[model samples]
Target: MSTTPPPDISFEQDALGRLILIAPGGTRHVNVHPAKMFPLTEKDHWISIQSENSREILCVEDPQTLPEPSRSLLLGALARRDFVPIIQVIHRIVRMADGHQWHVTTDRGDTTFEVETDESIQNLGHGRLVIVDRRNTRYLIPSVPSLDRVSKRKLEHYY
Candidate 1:
């Protein structure tokens, strides 16, 4: 028999009435209001959570920006069993030409892995971007509209 403890599990209800699940070594933020559960799989440190309603899968590359409420819920769930949080912030997105090869940089370190893409490269969006860190950790990033106008040149010339 193995002595390793089982993964942690917790659930939260979002504004949209979806129940999200946060598990050890992985996070599953689901829209369960529609009574659907999507299976998320992790391979080599990369985690992909599929959407049952739209057939869309979200790939997370960072966990630090994860909202406080979600993180708190996840931490609470993990703490139930005496395990500590191991996931951290995401560094950057690793762009690849081939669909199979990919990499993600995180505060912990850089992790390389493979994922089967259903379509061509897609943009995260303009409002909030969800990312998964090196440990299959999940987080969200705010993409405020005003940020689009801000540039490195603007900051450098501000003085």
Candidate 2:
């Protein structure tokens, strides 16, 4: 059996710099968000262009298949939307009755947040780690081996 290719959806910003999704379905979807369907694995593929009202304007299988201008526009929006801080150092981790309060220094700046469970700390296949706070803010530890001895020692208790 054979499968046909996906639609050729065009994307461009309006006069006010707002994303416009010109879907093959002929609807000009405005206020669209280019969200990755599988960010961890297919970081560049399987994108869902949705509207402000949660309507799917287009489902792109491979961004590379789209026109360069449209692909670049969607990729730029996805980069801005998924802004997870890269944790550089673990300053402190205070264990409390309900959860642990983490004080870490990220590439951006210093930050503090609470982790409700050990499950919140996920291993992203590689040495990379992603810590999700109680409020659902994600912090990325790019590499475990890249951290200093002191920071690694502080994080070992939970590892």
Candidate 3:
């Protein structure tokens, strides 16, 4: 069994001038502005923190399961003086189609996507792809081009 303790949580800034919270699981809550404090509370299966400007809360469960690079990045940001904390949400998964599409979302209402790889698929079952969001969050998708199906419209636009 592993002997590592739960990851430490900290708030810091990214290169985009947004405030972010580094959770124990290597998951980063980004787009946080300075002078903002996220309200933290522990629940049954997860820990949640709310954004200072909005009521939305990000939650993480068993944060120790996060990978190493994310943990290191968070630690580095906290140690740096210029870093700020911002909240962001990322979801990575392989989507099946003709090419690879990488999508990124931020709290500032900016969305970007680009083609990462291009190839023809004869059989998708043999392909294994890793999709990463933010920095630490990841998921497995069968194909790369399927990400385009996601709607880029904001939640507020519908409400």
Candidate 4:
């Protein structure tokens, strides 16, 4: 793809390190955030850039379709935004009166979190799962079968 900025659209960073969008008609949108339309399935496609008020400013079909710095900036923004930790192993799960406390090892490191209900655990099919904790932090289990026998056994109780 060309490194040149698309004919009239461009993206840049502001002094405060926020993504700034320079629209086709020379309009500038500041503090614009990028959100994946289909975050789990089509991560690289259909990204929506929104304003501080959460209004859609632009829809990028593919980051690669964008020009130069804009593409790189958008991808970096998405990476920082979609910061889900991948759960590598389940160390323990303690049931409480209110919720279940999960102790696990993730790609980042080991941590414990509280899962309020079974609904917090979502099955994405293809052996994938996403567990949302009480704090609303999402942890990804890329493949259920890939887990160790003990980890799988611990998780079996939930699903």
lDDT of 4: 0.87
lDDT per residue for candidate 4 within 1-159, as digits (tens), equals 112234567789988899998877789999999889888899778888889999887777777877788889988889899888999999999999999999999999999999999999999999899999999998999899999999999989654
* Model 1 lDDT, residue 102, Cα: 38
Model 1 residue 109 CA deviation (Å) reads 1.3
lDDT of 2: 0.81
lDDT of 3 at 43: 15
Q: In what order do the candidates fall by TM-score, top score first?
A: 4, 2, 1, 3
- lDDT tens digits, residue span 67-127, model 1: 6675454334333423112213333334456444334433445555443442322235554
Identify the candidate with maximal TM-score: 4
Q: Model 1: which residue pairs collide?
A: 60-131, 60-132, 61-131, 61-132, 62-132, 62-133
Off by over 4 Å in 1: 1-75, 78-98, 118-124, 127-159
Which 10-residue window of candidate 4 scores lowest in summed lDDT? 1-10
Off by over 4 Å in 3: 1-13, 16-30, 33-45, 52-54, 72-159
Q: Rank the candidates by lDDT, best first.
A: 4, 2, 3, 1
Candidate 2 per-residue lDDT over residues 1-95, each given as its tens digit: 11114444688898887888876656688878877777767777888877898766557888778777887887888888887789999988999
lDDT (Cα, 0-100) at 152 in candidate 3: 19
By lDDT, the best candidate is: 4
- After best superposition, candidate 2 residue 137: deviation in angstroms? 1.5
lDDT of every model, 2 decimals: 0.36, 0.81, 0.39, 0.87
Candidate 2: give the clashing pairs. Answer: none
Which candidate would rank higher by TM-score, 2 or 4?
4
